[model samples]
Target: MTFASWQFAVFAAIVFGVYYLPPVRPFQVQLLVAASLFFYGYGQPELLPLLGIAVGGTYLFLVLALRDRRWLPVGIIFNLALLAFFKYKFLFFDPQAPALVDIAAIDFLLKLPLPIGISFFVFHNISLLVDLTRDKKAPLPSPTDVFLYIIFFPQLVAGPITRAGLFLPQIEPKRFSDVQLVEAAKWILIGFFFKLYVANNLNEMTSHMDFPFYETLQTQDRWLLVILYGYQIYADFFGYSAIAIGLGLLFGYRLPINFDLPYISASFSEFWTRWHISLSTWLRTYLYIPLGGNRCGKFRTYLNLIIVMGLGGLWHGVGPSYLIWGVMHGLLLAVERPFLKKFEGIKSAGFRALRIAAVFFCVTMLWIFFKLPNFDHALAYLAGMFRPSTNPNPTKLYYDLALLYSLPVILQHLHLNSFFERRLAAWEPYVYGALAALAYLEAGPATAFIYFQF
Candidate 1:
């Protein structure tokens, strides 16, 4: 269930209530593992076995890999196979067809809907195998611990992908007194505010950016919607990550921080470092370094960058638009590399501001590909951004509403919100209370978290 829903609220409350009882302390990991299974199964019961096989099989492979380092590559390949089969198989075969593979079991497997968290859990599996195996002397973890690590409910679906090295050692019986209630409250409150009051409201305005609907927008409105979408996506994802982090705190498990002020980044590489920090870190550690990273010659490094980014793009989906989006990002990173030191040498605020604007503009524009997955539609939307509107009737947008809803993200990125928060330190509780009220009262039409599609 969605974090924003009443059902989830009830579910979380029930789980939380039983989670910290004196009697339940010893069974914390087992309780959480069961709760996580229930949480995943609630929405897609049919995929429960798939989830089991994924975790169970990964655990089995982990056992083998630990005993024989030679099996490490085999374990990694097994997880990759699962990811590739679910993520890219549709590109080659249509499950909708009547009789492509007449075998009932194989057809059923093909027809099975993509599990919601396959991408994320698969990554967790790989991390488990790699991180644990690397030590060589680390003791084998219990099956229950492995299950909890892979399927931890907070970061399971759309993740601030916690690495195995970072997350595994944190497993222990937690005390109620140790809960960071204030910090958790702050995270949860800010997350809900962003998701409901900011992202959801902006989603209404940016809905016009969808494929056919975008064709009716005025020229300037196209650009405007792109900026709003950039904000909305940030709010949506940051909100989810924040909530996940906060929930992890409640459970005494700390997930990684997923975002910084990414929009203020003056370079594409800096932007990646700030945005989706966990995923970028994952790619850098597991993929880029393994591929030789920048240790090789410049040409090889550039090729490695492109390859990693292209695969990163394909990881989101098998769409051409995703590939183009990723490749373009890679190109930007490569193009900026040689000039980075020179750019850093400039100390002027105006020049820095200009660079930030340029980076933000490019990043926002690239989001067009994400907004419209169809290559032609993405190209059409980009084309419209530079041309005059030709539609006989253009969709109207409320500029006042747009500014009001987007003010938080803007102020946040500028660090103005921090200034105000410090200035009104004594009124902190009241300000957050007001935000909570406004989030509930002003929340817009509900939409699924965007990254859930992955």
Candidate 2:
């Protein structure tokens, strides 16, 4: 279930109450783990074994950490195997492949429903193992701590991808701080505005311009969708992140900030440093650096960056589109590497704003690669935007263009960076109270978060 939905709000309220009660203190972690499992299973009950088996086995492996750290590799491999089986195996070969006729379990494996947050869970667990191995100073969290770490519902679906090292230590149920409570309220309100007002507006517009209708739009109508789409996804995702972080604060936990006005970055490297900071960092730490980071020669570093990002792209889905998206970002990162010096001097308000707009548009253009099913569809949509046809189109909502343009510049600029920090610094309880109310009123249909599908 979506955390932004009424059902999830109800779930969180129940969990929150039970979590803080003194009598339930000792078992709170177990309660959370159970809730996590229940939450994951609520929509797709059939995927229980697929998620449970791995989670349980990983728990066991970690419990045996002192005796056999060696088991970590085996455990990760086993989890990856499960992930491959359920998420990636069928995606490897197209349905039309001649080799498909020889398979027996192909139908079962291919058609199996994916468990929500499989990638997040598996990767977080890997981080746990890596921490245990690399930073021996790190203490292994209690079973309950570990359980809560994996199960925290906010980031569970589409995540800022919380880390055990960061979250497990905050396992105890503490009294709510007035300041944190207030910050949570601000987050809830701001996030609500973005999700409901900004993102939804763009989404409605884009829904009209989908494949069928998209091919027939006039140039002006076509560009309108691209701009709207860009705003829609940005608002949708970043709005979710803000709310998640806010909710974390209400529970007295601090989540790492996710967005940093990435569109404002003057260069591509700056964009990577700012956008989806969590995933980028995760990939760098776990995948790139280990594979031979910049310590190698320049060319090797670039290769590693491409490889890391390429796989990172594939991590999003089992399609060439995602591969292209990943590669495109990688290439952008590569080319922009040497141009940072040129961009560093862009400081005037007018120039900075223009740079942000340009970058935002560029990023939005790439987002087509992320949102569309394939390159052909993306090209068609792009084509439609530039060349109008008399053919039919989806319910295009050009009326929302003015609102969408103001989104990134006005609403989005509200939380550039250190937003969480600034709220915490303010430390007012009323903020969180306001947030709780907003979350209550802005309830969605309880759709699973977009990232959860990954």
Candidate 3:
């Protein structure tokens, strides 16, 4: 169930009540496992077996590898193969191939649904095995712990992608302090505001505009739409991460921060570092470092960055647009590295602001490829932004609505950067109350988070 839904609200409330009861507290881990499995299987019961196989197989393989060490590859391959079969099958194979008509089994396999959160869970399992193999001194978690780590409901879907080492220790029961409860409530309130009010409203505003009509808009209107989309996606994904982290805290598990004001980043490399912090860390640790990272020569390092990012993009979806998006960032990063080094000594505030603006503009433009389904449509939209249009002008109402909706988020970013330089702790309660009221008054509709499709 989506976080914005009444169903999830009821589910969370019931789970929270049961979890904190004195008698039920000791069996918290088992209770959470059962709750998580139900959460994952609520919409698709058929996929429950797949999750079981992944959890079971990974745990078993890790156990075997502890003795033989040779079983490590076997474990890794098994998980990766399962991931590829579900995620990449449609991209790599044709179900209707003439020769496959005689083989009903092959066609059926090709037509299977891509399991929800397959990418996330597979990465978690892989990290578990890799860490075990790398650190022989580390203790192996019991199968129950392994299952909980992979299926914890808060992060089971779109995730901050917790590591086994960081998350496992928190499985033990702990007292929930008032301070922790307040902090979790604060995050949940902010998350609801972002998703229900900001992202959902923006989605409704732009829902009518499709590729066919995009070329008919004036240049100014197109740019405005593009800017709105940039913030919409940011709010949607960041909102999900905020809720996940807040829920993790409620459960006494500290999940990592996923975002850090990415729009203000001064370079593409810095952008990656700030945005999706957990996934980027995973990619660096698991994929980049193993491929020699920057330890190799400059050329190899550039190649590694490209390959890693390209795969990272493909990880999001098996689409040409996604690949192009990755390649664009990789190329920009490669070019920005030497430029950043040469200008490292520039300390002017004006220069810094200019750099931030330049980076933001570039990133916003690149988001065209990320948003559009077709590569050609993205290119056409970019072209429309440059060439003058004789089409009808967008109404002043549209501009005003866009500005009103977007201003709050922009002010939030400024406040985060210490622009006001005022202490907000004393006003925290009122701030939360204001956010909640705004969300309640302005919420458009219950909508799935953008990252859920991934």
TM-score of each: 0.98, 0.85, 0.94
The TM-score that candidate 2 achieves is 0.85
Candidate 2 C-alpha lDDT tens digits along 1-454: 7755678789888887777777876776677778878888887887777766766777777767646678777777876787777678765656555555466676655666677788888887777777766666776667667667766766777777777778877777576443287678677666775676566545656665566656656677677677667666667778889888888777667788898777667666778888888889889888898889988888988888789889988888878878888887888777767666777666688876677677777787877777785778877776666555676543445474646434543544566335655757565455445444544564333333456678
Which pairs of residues clash in candidate 1, taking residues 3 or more apart in a chain or in different chains? none
Task: Please report how far candidate 3 places residue 315 from its true position, in Å.
Answer: 0.9
Ranking by TM-score: 1, 3, 2
- Indicate the residue-level lDDT of 85 in model 3: 84
> Which candidate achieves the best lDDT against the true structure?
1
The per-residue C-alpha lDDT of model 2 at residue 374 equals 74
TM-score of 1: 0.98
What lDDT is obtained when candidate 2 is compared to the true structure?
0.71
Number of backbone-clashing residue pairs for each candidate, in the order shown? 0, 12, 0
Q: Quote the RMSD, in angstroms, for model 3.
A: 2.3
Q: What is the C-alpha lDDT of each candidate?
A: 0.92, 0.71, 0.83
Candidate 1 structure quality by residue, lDDT tens digits, 1-454: 9899998899899999999999999999999999999999997899999899989988998899888889889889989999999888888897678865879898888887888978999999999999999988777889999999999998999998888878889999999999999999899999999999999999999989887999999999998999999999999999999999999999999899999999999999999999999899999989999999999999989999999998899899989999989999999999999999999999999999999999999999999988888999999999998999988989999999999999999999999878978798899989899889989999989999998889
Candidate 2 lDDT for residue 13: 86
lDDT of 3: 0.83
lDDT score of residue 323 within candidate 1: 95
Give lDDT: candidate 3, residue 363.
87
